[model samples]
Target: MTSARIALVTGANQGLGRGLVEGLAARLGPDDLVLLTGRNAERVAGAVAHVAADPATRSRVAGRVLDVTDADAVARLAAELHDQYGGVDFVVSNASAMLTPDRSQSAQADDFIDVANGGALAVLRSFAPVLRAGGRLLVVASSLGTLGHLDPRLQPLFDGASLDEVEKAVESWRTALHTGTAEELGWPRWINVPSKVAQVAAVRAVAAERRDTDLPADRLIACVCPGLIDTALSRPWFTDFSGAQTPAQAATAVLDLLLTERVDPATYGELVRFGRVLDWHDGTPPQLPDGLLVN
Candidate 1:
């Protein structure tokens, strides 16, 4: 018999998170289990039932309550998975916080610190070590976070830097924002750009740390931009949904990347879209069509 193929998705009660659960449900083997997690138990169970209602995924999906912001909870989940299954085969950090409706400075700052940085950072700290040999760690991020967005001086902060350094830079951004010096400090007015860049940098930093270990080649890990999807996260920012892909459509693309048997070394720790590793270093597409969700 084959080993149980275990996979987990964070913040999967709705939107792209739910779509990813359905996509994984359709692809996982009979013996495999895909855990869809959310902060609320009821919501997560509902999502699991809804996805499992489909005959193709009827027996393959389950739900768990996990609030990624709580480092203790994340650590416990990691320990539980390691003890129960020896480790996970695939994990996607998809539960990210977005700017709130009011879009107040404090709210945006909360999103950045709590969900974007704290949440993603916690997941990586806990799960990266518990990933099964040759497993995959896919961080859900936006193309807007690429290094190219930062001024040339700030770009070096992420390139080959340690996790501490990346985190320090993130803290510096927060400090600047609170002091109203963010713009003068070269931080973009659209804070998500810096938030995402730091988030992805943390991923790369973790991967680099793992490489120094004597452990046999570690898991396949990278940040993936799920493209412009018509979801709660993007709908508010964009007036047009015509150009956006359905959550399921975008989810399929991400699933394809996760389930691939082999990926080029260059793609590791890079920002990818639909299996294509993006040129995140210096930026690209000299010019982009206005109001389009190309990423």
Candidate 2:
């Protein structure tokens, strides 16, 4: 008998992460396994129970405690997957930290760069070796982080012809933020936008790196935007917003990318929003009501 396909999702206790796990559990083959991971053990356990409650998905769902920002924790998980399952077939880097109004500029920068950007990189880096050939990697990003929000001068760097250049561009933004020159450097003051931008760029870089190496040509690595879901992270702005989507609705978009029978190479490094490939590079910035969302 063939071994079961394995999928791992970070921050799977609640919100979009939970929805993604649930959707996968319901749709994946009966022999497949879905590992729902979170930073809190109790929360992860509860989420596992919730997903496992359904008889159809019960045997395929399990939970793990993982803090994506912690290198040791990530390494441990990767090692376990290697030993027990050979490798994972799908990895979803869904964990993220958002900036709150009370945070100082420095604090916000740390949360965005260190927590959000850094955490996603850690997940991808540590798990890369353990990702099965022809596997798929999905990084959850935001539309707010599109290059359209950046100054034209900086756009070239993020959209550079090579991964190395994109990495340098992301570093430049971080340096500007640390030195209090972000505004002068033409970076948005909003923490989420740049952080998500960096993530989207990182996806491109990873795909490029793998393409130039021995990894399978069919490996799918891409960033996806859930598009303003009404979750804890977006509650402040989403409560009064008319266009907010339920977490389940957002999860369907991600699930389609992960479980589809055919993998489209064109989407390997693009940001997909609402089932469409958003031209974030040249698209117009989204405008929301004042105070409805912070910059």
Candidate 3:
């Protein structure tokens, strides 16, 4: 019998993360392993129960309490994954947070600090050692990060901004709004650049670094936007009019990409939407018509 294949997903208790777990379990066989994790122990347990209750998924389910913001915990989890499973086939970074709802009214830097920089980066670094060749790392990113989607005046946000920079900017924006100094009254609905760029860079780095490793094929890493998915993380403005997909539908697309078997280096760091790959600049995958879902 073949050993079980292992996949780890952060923030898997709900939303897209939850959907990805379900989709993968539906498609993959009994010998596959899926680890559902989140910051809340109860949510993690509930997610595990949800998967285990499924007759199809019961045999392959596992659970972990992982808050991606904890750097030491991430490193420890890496060690545990390596020791227990030998290696992992996939690592999905789905955790996220906001410094404040009103991007121009609050000064809470904790949100960006935890979500963009520490959380996403922790996901990458923690699993680097355990992500074997041929594995895939998919970061649930946003189209807002695309340099093109941003107003030309906002280019600086995407150009040289790091995760820390994002935190600072959000904090600045929040303060401005609170102080009634900004013209805008809403949160700056932009993608976090550090998280997005890190996903792409991490994949490339892993592939290049492991080019000569005894592994069979290079790992695939990608940043994807599931469009205006109906999730708690999204703004009401998005759900109000944007084309939105259910978490289940979005998960299906993500799983399809992860289980494709063919790992394309070009797909690394690119945005996958509507089951198609797109260039980051244009926000649409290649070979599709204009005004498609990606754009």
Candidates in order, TM-scores: namely: 0.90, 0.87, 0.75
Clashing pairs in 1: none
Highest lDDT among the candidates is held by which one? 1
lDDT of 1 at 175: 81
Q: Kindly list the per-residue Cα lDDT of model 2 for residues 1-295, writing each as its tens digit.
A: 2388899999889999999998888888888999999888999999999888977573388898888878778988888888898988888999977655444545556656765677777777778777777678888988766788666766777674454565566677878877888877777666566677778877777777775442344667788988888887776444476887888888998998887666776676778886677775755435533452222
lDDT of each: 0.80, 0.76, 0.64
Name model 2 segments beyond 4 Å from true: 55-59, 161-172, 212-217, 284-295
Candidate 2 pairs with clashing backbones: 190-295
lDDT of 3 at 22: 83
Pairing residues by index, what is the TM-score of model 2? 0.87
What's the residue-level lDDT of 258 in candidate 2? 83
Writing each residue's lDDT as its tens digit, candidate 1 over 1-295 gives 2379889999899988999889888887888889999899999989988998887673378889999989899999989989988989889998876654345554378555777787788888899988887688888998876788787777888888788898788888788878878767776666667788888898889877775451355467889999899887776667777879998998987888788776557778778888888776856212322342311
C-alpha lDDT of residue 135 in model 1 = 81
Worst 10 residues of 2 by lDDT: 286-295
Stretches > 4 Å off in candidate 1: 100-102, 211-218, 284-295
User: What TM-score quantifies how close candidate 3 is to the native fold?
Assistant: 0.75
Per candidate, the number of residue pairs that clash is 0, 1, 10
